[model samples]
Target: MVDTNETHVIVGAGLAGAKAAETLRSEGFTGRVILLGDEREKPYERPGLSKKFLTGAEERDALRVHDPSWYTAHEVELHLGQPVTALDREAKEVRLGDGTAIRYQKLLLATGSSPRPLRVPGADLAGVHYLRRLPHAERLRAVLRNLGRENGQLLIVGAGWIGLEVAAAARGYGAEVTVVEPQPTPLYGVLGPELGGFFADLHRDRGVSFQLGASITEVVGQDGMVLAALTDTGEELPAHAMLIGIGAAPDTALAEAAGLEIAPREEGGGVAVDASLRTADPDVFAAGDLASAYHPVFGRRLRVEHWANALNGGPAAARAMLGREVVYDRLPYFFSDQYDLGMEYSGYAAPGEYAQVVIRGDAGKREFIAFWLDGENRVLAGMNVNVWDVTDPIQRLVRSRRPVDPERLADPGVPLDALPG
Candidate 1:
C-alpha cells in the first residue's frame, strides 16, 4: 500500500527530522526519503551537551542519534551541510543553498531553535560564549578546562537551566562560577519563586555565587577577550569567560517564508499547526521546537523546546503524514540534572495559572514531588525531584483534571495511585 512514486522531504536534520525519516522507512514507506541538515555532523541529542558532555564525563560519539551507517543502510537520502534556503509551496519544492531544488510530495519542517543572542557591549569578545551546537559545547569544555587550571572565574548571565547546568559543569572543572539573573531567583519563570529559591540555595551550597535581581549591562573585555561583566546594579564581576543563556527562539524562517501561519508570541510563537501536526497547507507539516502545536488536553497551542518533544513529535508527524490518525496530546515534560539533584517535570502551568503548589515528602532534603493546582485543587503540573517511577501516576493525575484533598496529596503515607484524581 506504499506510494512508490512519492517523495517525502524533511528539513533541519536534527533529532526530529532524523527520527521522522527512520519512522517512515520502518512504517513501510517505500517513497523516497530525503533528510536535509545545515550542519555537517550527524544528528545528535542535545540534553547531554549541558550535563555529561560539558562535565567531561561523556564522549562526543555518545550524542549521535544514529550511527553514520544507519542512514545508508536504511536507504535514507541523507544530505548534510546543505541548508534549505527557500520553499516554493506551489511548486512543491525546497531550494537549497547550493541552488538545488528538490521536489517533494510531502514536506516536514523540523528546524530547531537557536540561542537568543546577548546584545550587550563586548558580547562579541573571544571569551564570551553561547551553547547551542556541538561545536559550541566542545569549545566551552576546552575553555572550562583551561580556566579551571588558571583559577579563573566564569560569569554566567541568566540563571535558567542551561546557565545553572553549565555552572554545575564549571564547578566540576574547579572553576569559580557566578550566575547573574534579573529574576529574584533561579528558574523563576518556570518553577516560580517557591521552588526557584530551592535551586538558589542548592547552587549556593555547591560553591556557586549568585547575583539575583541583576542583569549584565555590559561585557568588559581586554584584547578581544572577556575580563569582567558589569551589572545594571553598578557591580562589576571579574571573570575570565562569560556565558549568555537567556533562552532560545524557535527557528521558523522556512515555514514563515512559505506563507505558513505562525503563532503569536503570546501563544508560544512558532509555526502554527493543528492537533495532527499539519499546517494549513495540508502537505506541509511542522514538528519539534519549530511547531506551535494544538494540544487536545491543554486546549491550547504549545511550542516545547525540550529534548522529549523532538524525540516524540517527529514520529507522530511521520505517522500522520502517512495518512494515519494522530492526535499529539503529549504533556509538556522536561528534566534537569544539576549536581546530585535530578528532577522530572510533567504537564504545564505558568506562574499565574496555578493558585497553590503542594509538596509531598521533605523539600529540604530534595526528595519530593511538588504539584501545582488550580483554585479547585485540580492538578495542573507536577515535578518530582530525586524521586523515581512516579511519572505515570503524576501524568494521570494531571490528565484526570479532578480535584484532590490537599492534605492527602501532601501526605507521604498516602499512595499517589490510590488517591482520587
Candidate 2:
C-alpha cells in the first residue's frame, strides 16, 4: 500500500518520465506525482520528430504522449519548461531552473539526451539544423517546404538512423541530398558492412548520393547562411542547408553534480544503475537514455538510446522505486523507416561481439531476417528488414540462448518456429 501523502518526483517529461508517472498511478500510488520538463510543451512521442511529423503526415498534438486533460485528471503536476538545475541529495530535493526547490520521497532521473553539437567552424550559421526535438523537426519541415523540389541541396552529416531518415524526407521534397559518413558504410558498426551496404544501395536507388568514409572538416557559409560543406579529402559539397546527425550525449549534469556514480564512456556513459535501476542512493533511480543499466542477459551494462528502452525501462524503474522485486532484462529493440525500407531490430550486440551473421532471405531483395550468432551458434541478436511477423520467433531464438545449426536457421523451408530452441 502506498502512503498517499508521500511525493514521487520525475525529472524529464519525455516518454520515460511520462511512462513512469503513469505507472506510479496504475501501481496504486496516490502520492503526489510531479513530472518536470525543460520544454514548454507537454510530453510527446519523439519518434515522429524524424518520421510522420517531419513529413507533415501527422499533426503536432498527435505526437503528445498524453493529452493535457489526462495529466489534469490524473493529478500529475505539470512542471513544463522548468528544468531541474540541481539535485540536493542531502535535502532530498531538486532545484529547478526558476530556483524553486521541491522535496521528494522518491526521485527518478529520466533526463534524456541532446544532440551532440558539431564543433566545426560555421556550425552556428543559419540553414543548419539538428533533428532531436519537436521544434527542430518543425523548423526543418518549414525549410523543406520553402526550399521546394529540386530547388536546393541538403547535406546530411552522419549515416545513422536519423541521418538516413532525414535524407529520405529531404529527397521526397525534391531536394538534392548527399550524406557524409565517416564510416565505410551506413550503419556499418551495428548492422555490419554487408547489411549496411544494402541500405547504402537502397538510398542510391532512390537518387540519394553518399560520401562514405568521409568527414566534414568545416561548414562554409556566406553572410551567416550555409553555402557548402568542405570534407577532409578537399572535396566541397554544395548545400543550401545542412543537418548534423552524429549522435547524442546524455544529459547528466544534474546527476553528476549530485555525486551519482556514472558508467565509463566505453560502457555508454550515463548514471550507473544496477539491474533494478537503483542508483547508489536507494531513494533515487535512473532510467531511459540517461541510465546505464546492467543487463542480465548481456552480462554487462548498457545504455540504449532507442524508444523501446524508455518504454520498458521507465515502468521497470517505477516498480523498483516502490520496493518491488523487478529486473530490467528486456531485449533492446528499435525500428526505422526510410522510403520503402522498413526494419525492426531486437536484442543487442556491439559489432564484432558476435561471430557470424546468418541470413534467412535475400538481402539483395531487402526482404530478410538476419541473425547474429556467437561462436557457439547461439543467437545474440536478430533483425528483420522489409519482413513482417517474425519478430516473436527471432526474439525467442535470442532469449533461449541455445545453439542451433546455422543451415537450418538460414533455410526458409525450416520455418523460424521450427528452429531448435
Candidate 3:
C-alpha cells in the first residue's frame, strides 16, 4: 500500500536524482517527492558536457533530462539552486543552505561529484578551466571558439576521458591542444598500456601533442591570464588556456556529516551502501556517483561515475527504497567518443586484475574488440571500438565467468556466443 503521507527527498538535481523522483512516481508511490539541486539549472546529463555540447553540435536545452513541465505535471517538487546543507538523521529532516528545513521519511543522496582541481601555482588564473557543470562547459565552449579563431594553444592537464574528449573538441574548433599526462600513455589506468598507445596515436594523428610521463609543476600567467605551463620535465608549453581533468571526487559532505559509512579510497570512496543501495541508516540511501554500492555479482563495492551508472542506478535505488528487491549487479559500462572513433567498454578490470588482453579484429584500423581476461582466461572486461551490436555478447561473456580459449577469443571467425562462457 502506498503511503500518501510519507515524503521522500532526493538531494542533488542531476540525472540520478531526477530519475529517482520519476521512478518513485511511476512506481505508484503516492507520496511527496522533493528533488533539490545546488545549480539553478534543471536536472541534466553530464555526458554531453564533454562531447557534443562542448563541440557546438548540441545546444544546452538538449542536455536536459526532462522538460521543465514534466516535474510540475508529475507533482514532483523541484527546487533549483537550493543545496542541502545538512542532514539530520535523528530529526528526519534536511537543512537547506538558506536554513530551510524539510522533513522526509526517506532520503536519497544523488549528489554526484566534482572535478578534482589542479593544485599547481596559478591554477586559479582566469583562463584555467575544469569541465564539471553547465557553467564550466559554457565557458569552455566560448574559450575553444575564440582560441580556434586565433589559432591559440590549449594546454590540458591529465589524459583521462575528459581531457581526450576536450582535446578532440578543441581540435574540431582548430585549436592547438597539448595534453600533459603523468602516465606513460593516455588512458593508462583504464585501458592500460596495451591499448593506451592506440588512443595516443589517435590524438596525434589529428594534430594533438602529448607530454607523456610528465606532470605540470606550475602555470605561468600574467595579469590573471594563463600564458604557459611549466612541466616537471623542465619544458615550458605555451598555452592561452588550461584544462584540469585529473578525475572527480564524490560529493559526500552531507552523507559524511550525517554519519554515513564511507568506503576506503582504494575501494572507490563514497557513501557505502549495501546491494540494495541502502546505507547503514535504513531510511537513507545513496545512488549515482555518490554511492559506493556493493555489487552482488562482483562481490565488491564499486563507485562508477559514468552516465550509465546514474541513468540506471537512480531507478534501481528508487525501487529499492520502495521495498523492492534490487541487487544492482549491472556490469560497469561506459562509452567515449573522440574524433571518428566511438567505443563502449563493459565490465571492470582494473590494472593487475586481468592477466591477458585479447583483441579481435584490427587494432590499427580502430575497429576491434579488446577483452581483458584473468589468468584462467575468464573474461573480466571487454571493449568494442567502432563495433556495433556486440555489447550483449561481451556482457554475457563477462557475466558467464567461464574460461574460454585465448586463441578462440582472439579469432575473428569464432562466434563469441559459440565459445564457452
**Against the hidden reference, what TM-scores do the models get?**
0.98, 0.98, 0.99
Scored by Cα lDDT, where does model 3 land? 0.94
RMSD of each: 1.2, 1.4, 1.2
Model 1 regions more than 4 Å off: 1-4
Runs with alpha carbons beyond 4 Å of true place in candidate 3: 1-4
lDDT of each: 0.93, 0.91, 0.94
What would the TM-score be for candidate 1 when compared with the true structure? 0.98
lDDT tens digits by residue: candidate 3, 1-421: 3455899999989999999999999998998999999999999999999999999999999999999899989999999999899999999999999999999998999999999988978899889999999999999999999999999999999999999999999999999999999999999999899989999999999999999999989998999899999999999999999999999999988899888999999778999999889999999999999999998767899999999999999999999889998888899999999999999999999887889899999998899999999998999999999998999999999999899999999999999989886
Residue 28 in candidate 2, Cα distance off native in Å: 0.5
Looking at model 1, residue 4 earns an lDDT score of 54
Q: What does the lDDT read for residue 343 in candidate 3?
A: 97
Using lDDT as the measure, name the better of candidate 2 and candidate 3.
Answer: 3
Q: Per-residue lDDT tens digits of candidate 2, residues 263-369?
A: 99977899999999999999999999999999998889999999999988999999998889999999989999888889999998677788898998988888999
Please rank every candidate by TM-score, starting with the best: 3, 1, 2
